[model samples]
Target: MIQLHSGSVMLQGGVPAPIPAAGSGRDKTMAYQILRRHHRGPWEGQLHLTFDSLISHDITYVGIIQTAKASGLREFPVPYVLTNCHNSLCAVGGTINEDDHAFGLSAAVKYGGNYVPANQAVIHQYAREMMAGCGRMILGSDSHTRYGALGTMGVGEGGPEIVKQLLRNTYDIAAPQVVLVWLTGTPPHGVGPHDVAIALCGAVYGNGFAKNKILEFAGPGVAHLPMDYRIGIDVMTTETACLSSIWQTDDAVAEYLTIHGRPEAYTRLAPEEGACYDAMISIDLSRLEPMAALPFHPSEAVTLRELLHDPGDYLRQVEQRAAEQFGGKATLSLTDQVVDGKLVVQQGIIAGCAGGMYDNIAEAAAILSGGDVGCGPFSLSVYPPSIPVNLELMQNGVQQALLEAGVLFKPCFCGPCFGAGDVPANNALSVRHTTRNFPSREGSKPGDGQLSGVLLMDARSIAATARNHGVVTSAAEVDYPAPAPVRRTFDGGVYGRRVYFGYGKARPEAPLHYGPNIAEWPAIPPLGEELLLQVASVLRDPVTTTDELIPSGETSSYRSNPLKLASFALSRRDPDYVPRARATQALEEARRSGAIPPELQSVQKALSIPDMGRVQIGSVLFANKPGDGSAREQAASCQRVLGGCANLCYEFATKRYRSNCVNWGMLPFTLAEGTDFPGCPGDFLYVPQVREKVTRGDEEFPALLLTDSGIHALTLYLKNTTAEERELLLTGCLMNHYAAQNAAENRR
Candidate 1:
């Protein structure tokens, strides 16, 4: 039972309800006012940000530091903390995991950044506990770098974005229209943060309600929520396809900062008398019900009661979706799990930035505090956000209660989030309280013939279902009185005792140690006169996320090894992507060095083209909608390495991917509706004067015929690009741009 109130909204414990306030039509939100105060550009579609700060967690810090080292980074110019919660297991990848831990320590020492060793705390949770402050800006490598709930404007972007920040570069973008998410009423009981998030995602996800827009959470509804509850809802705003989000901070927030021992960070925030909103989405708190986001995507949400009454119909629909997701391979089955008129689940996991929150876990523990999860193939696991959190939970007896309940409590790690922990048996169903439930994310590889699917749910509901022995159940239906959490202070001693901290200290003289697998990027050929591609991978899906593009599991090791990682591009979706892309790469290498591979002879023979070993072959990829999740630049850089020259998409899923393309020197191309393209595998579409056109910002561009398919023109455009971005594209890439910039500076 979740409902939104009509007056001022507030969060009671983990529930969102309304608070009383004077009627005001429009008021500025804390987030909006900060963004407004720091407004740098009306460059129409351009926004340039020299981020006020940057942050990274255990999983991301290694890769970000590796990239920065490759680009000649000396020391961090701003505060940067490298947390180690993501790789706490240290059992799976053998020494490599520990190797990364060691490398992080050394890098932090070398670069003058703070290092919070494995198990200290999860990234966002730690940030909330220590870093977030009013009227500040932050950039993070992970997608959920949002602190709007705490009155700080934060963004989640790819590793390259972090690298740029490390180099003291600005995050260039267009001014996003700020949309006021007016919350008028309070929510009913039994509803948690996940409910509000699911409801919001259902409303704006498909329609792109807040895409690239500043989501200002205001109205009377915001004042009623506790700091943690608001943080829970705010962090998940990224799933709504919003650029960023912020709310009005009140005594609750100040109390939060004070309780966390960071009282100096709190600052009262409010909007101006009248704030303008490009659009408004008013959520009625009381109307929300217990929700469930089915398999595949978060947008497939339905009320739990509606789903439980007749799940066969909905389960069948999800099975069909699974089929399409697996490309009709029928690798994973959802309907088969139905037995005795109930959907059976084998595993329950509450982990990651979303589920590892203090309140959610405490609430879940209260529900399952004493009950034993019978040992009948049903397993329950919990991952606290960080080491400090885990210690606190242990000190407070929450850990003991979970242990007594037969739940396996593990140290902080992102293994389950990326398929490294708690892998379900083939043909098993697992319910999770995590960030995403995309295919293969549950440790079952469709390509490997393993079949399992994860269903996303909140921690409380998962606990309720666990309490019911895996039958679908809502947590709100359970009755329990929760005890006060025995508060525990952060034991920074562990960090100080074992980890390394180089706050105001920097050692630029220390050299980076690159592993053998770490290879520099290959030289990219200049734009071709005519294009030729074999349509190597054609995904007609509505949208393709970055996780599917390069995969996170097999490629995690190669994260620091770019060339090594490129070999696994599209490994999950198209196993042949690597081979096909490699063939094209051989062509590019041959054209560059005048040494063509054996495969090129056939192309020369067919087209009667000279085998002079100097022919350019630009690679191609076609997807209906691509680049949805993660700001990983590797999604594009990996393609560039495999001879990819351009992407032919009906539409791009996010602005970040398009930005990635431009920075990587790839043409972000699109075709009109019903525009049938003959370009297939074994052919290519070359772009003429591409570098010039990008430099001059051409509205329409012509394609030169180079391979089997006739040369055709397509319309391609760029969003507002910064001078730096344009220079990078024109010079082929940032490396080249920096070289040119330096040479010009030297000459001057």
Candidate 2:
């Protein structure tokens, strides 16, 4: 269904070929055209970009505003939209969730930004409806912040990146290669966007075919896809590890913008003839089957037909993976879910940015029109992307149809996507049309012996599964009448009335509301001449997700409080990590007070440094490849808050996660390929003149690893760091770096 080409190719008459060009035609691509418009730096190896607008959800907006506030932010320079969707349910953490909401509103007012109230709309949905425009660039704090279907380029990064934009700083990056996602043939009936997306993910994710590249979608298949269909595929591109995505626009895109009451946002976008791409991904949409990404990850996809053909074989793999991921802390019994050679799921959800679009829900409602969900453990739920979309569904009777079919309606929230709502019972399997199916993302606590698994599917197949009473039926096999098309209308007033539109109208005198749980970041010391990194946690996992670094779900409520949230860092992955890091922190505290602990006296003697005052002691974690999944800054910030000094990894799973570590002043250290990190808890690495070497732009550092066995020499790499990043590391972090600059300006 998907073909990947690694070699550079040029587009000739809307088709890609290996035609050689005298010079690179990358600048002619639609991605570069939009990127050049937003580029603040000259065309070179690096791009310094400033976005047109910014967005964040409640889970991240609090910490972003706090970081920006600490950096002397007076007003938002761009249209900053703070949407309270992630914490809308407020089912956890008592008043803390609501307190964060109030703080978001107050911050919006104080900083002259827009605020979408709880249940009004999810973050990306609001951006799609009101913010996305042709040739515009948006930076959001959510990983799935993609609006390429509407001709806009969206990049999702950690909250620190958003804070940089809020402070009018450039988002610096090495120039990215653009990949052509050429589409052809129409999608088969009952095959939805998630199928194409899941297949695309499976083809590219494992091979790194699209890693850190911009996916420029074009070709004949573009015309066949509706706005939402393109969006559904574009949003899931994050799973492919791509930096961002953009698509060629057509009248359908123009009509979509017009429906959203923004006709001016429409503009034709296409790759110029002879435009070159670093790689190409050709997808035959007609060949797609109803797909499902099994437990744990979105890349673990298989056709429902194949899964059901041998349910036992497929389900046994999931059970084995669950056992491995949770380390027997919780038991996952998926093989038992197979009844009479058919897999049975307990729940179905069609929600979030990737799934909760008008067309997806409407099609699902049509499939379940006259069929009942049945009074069994199996249930179905639908969440509209926004109030406007919900109103349109009600006006068109789609909502009533789903209700009559026994499908429960949910608020316009993103809880299901991130494990805050619609969590299944232990051992229950759920098929969802959500952004991800990462383990524990469905609100299962393996540490507490509660586990559930989610299978990512399109709304159509999920509806068909619901219709069959959760027998895991594919929509393609079910003969259902197609729903008639309705003219989609948008009620802009729904947002105008409920959302706080305070952009460009800052009230500096307004009091900033602060909940008790909200706390400012603690003081972090600057990099010393010498460094002492104690290995606090060692993870042998091939890739450590951000969810494991700092869990989502209930822990989201404590985001505003750095220390409180830090307590949950590595809680799920390494339950003993917090205490180990705390112990290392205590050692640092003692050293800062001019008393070197006896535990490190031997190491101090080994380094032959009489004075340990120049050495700064902090904890470090070693992982094979860390920072996958969410773009939440907490993944890195939580480590920094707990006195983390550096991350030793073979590589990072995504660019955003590396940026998070740099922004939080963590030394993004890498080892030589095939280098084994045998260091464990209580072992230490000492680097002399570390601050000097880093500021001097040295890519490699020499350090001595001290273990009970003996002393070993090691080489650590810190590559591709910008000058600002070096300064941040020197001064501790972004906030400290900004504060120092502000102080210097005041003195001047």
Candidate 3:
């Protein structure tokens, strides 16, 4: 069991005394300790951080670079890598796949960044291998850009955040309320990193206990777990919706960096005495067991033993709960899996960055060393996180063992994690050890006639299920080796052989290649004095994903093509969204140019207000909780593309989504928790100088009800807008800010 030490104290004498743990009345919790290490001045009660570096995978790179280009970014100041993994099949949207790669190369050369071609490695795997170092921060366009296990305070922010970094703007936010993840005990036999993360998510998600807080993982458990194990647990913290996470470094972290050939980057981080924490969460690793997030979300969990005792009852409850998630559009039946009074799963996969690590897969291999997967529809697939991880697993005989067991091993690719590959047949059930199992993330089309589903289990449970020929089983029933005979070493030169790394060559004259599909962002006007918007799309789901904003599979090709991709905004939910939004855009253009459209004018005349007041028109999205998964910037940019002005929300699912709204020049406004946003379709709500307020760091702004009720005021909080954020708002977007800056530089 993991051993956690609570005796640790502030190591340095000069750091400010740590703030007390919230609700505990105690001053020295783990959160306060780590916060002291990264502590700088309040910088005016809000801090704007310009990421020293940034990253993105195939799923997101094209979109980020395209946004940068549209914003008039001349060159990338910090390092960025574009990996081609999600669009590996080359099946979707014709040449859109290859064209993205070509665009990546040309853009990388033009911007002086790094480019890793498709199939070379998955994004996080490559990032862990090449990007992370102690005390450094990395911003990735992908949601799971977490590398805190490596002592790098890596954050997965939306593409707009990436654009800001490329444009040399800061990540502006209120100093997050820090939370101490105090851990103790080792995970019991058969328990895995997924188990720990799932448990933590369940504990803190429902109550916003750690929402927008910096998760400082500490305690004796910090040094007890192996590096890969820590990495596994660390990546999943994104699902907890925390602002970002960092861990107190020790020898293990040092060893990880040393092995990866960047020992110099390793530095220690911890909280000072009496460090402040907004909350405290205690984790007992010894208590964690083989866990499964049944369906829909990582928080819906049950122990394998608990599920096994009454499989039918448990399965029925899960199916019933899933009905509410699909907008009640479809039925998810799991009770049918009970055959001959025993539950049998259809498939198992241990793949992607989450499960592809050597230590985890090697244990799975040992369990299935000589077992057959059987000749039924039941199937098993193992994917390595990267070429190097795959090779080491090979040399360790894990590959041969799995192959003999009838398991199919795939190359390094993020396809399984985000709907790129291994799509199951309709109505089939598959379990995976991946970062997420969001609906439609498994490459299955929910809007289609038939539907497929996925459940999350550790590599061990997946192997056990594979061993029993897909009959449900828990990893706890079996005994496996704890560690490999020897820790694997890295030999991943595949990228070195293929990718072009231009480390800081300021070649302003380099020509960029733009494909026919690649298009510039539609012109967006400065933030207006008043906003009059129609509710283009209203999502009532628990959490709205970026994928729902703009699909990923075939759309990856169009990511570089703003107008093309924007046409598909909310394509899955409201097929009519693009048309309605485009129509509104015309109305917006008329309003912006002081010319009301004939149709709108006629409608306004019928309402007795022939001349609609001069106001800027933009699309408004109403959602209970949005921005659940993926740090994709398109979630906001697409709305910006469709003439969006602001988001009215009771709350946001992740801090990054809100930041995306600000960076795209869309006002992120929060309504009273229970207040209903009054708009059916054509209703108007006005928020004024939104531009100036956002720039001037006003905590509260007067929003108005644009009706006969006249000028009733409503308050919206800017929360943590920084100076750079204000500039982005004033200039209409980050891109415009950079363009003006670049032009000014040239003029000087």
Best by TM-score: 2
Compute the lDDT of residue 600 as modeled in candidate 2. 75
Which stretches of candidate 2 lie above 4 Å from their native place?
Answer: 20-23, 607-610
- Kindly list the per-residue Cα lDDT of model 1 for residues 483-590, writing each as its tens digit: 575554666465457656686798877655544544556665555544445567878778888888878754576665667778888887888887888877777766
Model 1: CA > 4 A from native? 1-29, 36-45, 70-72, 87-89, 328-330, 482-499, 513-519, 524-531, 595-616, 704-722, 746-748
> Global lDDT of each model?
0.72, 0.91, 0.74
**Per-candidate TM-score against the hidden true structure:** 0.91, 0.99, 0.90
Judging by lDDT, tell me the better candidate of 1 and 3. Answer: 3
Clashes in predicted model 2: 0
Which candidate ranks first by lDDT, i.e. highest? 2
lDDT of 2 at 64: 93
209: Cα error in model 2, Å: 1.0
In the range 555-627, model 3's lDDT, one tens digit per residue, is: 6666767777788787766566788787788887777677777866644543344235535678788777888
Q: What is the lDDT, from 0 to 100, of the residue 211 in candidate 1? A: 80
Report lDDT (Cα) of residue 23, candidate 2. 51
* CA RMSD of each candidate after superposition: 4.7, 1.2, 4.0
By summed lDDT, which 10 consecutive residues of candidate 2 come out lowest? 14-23
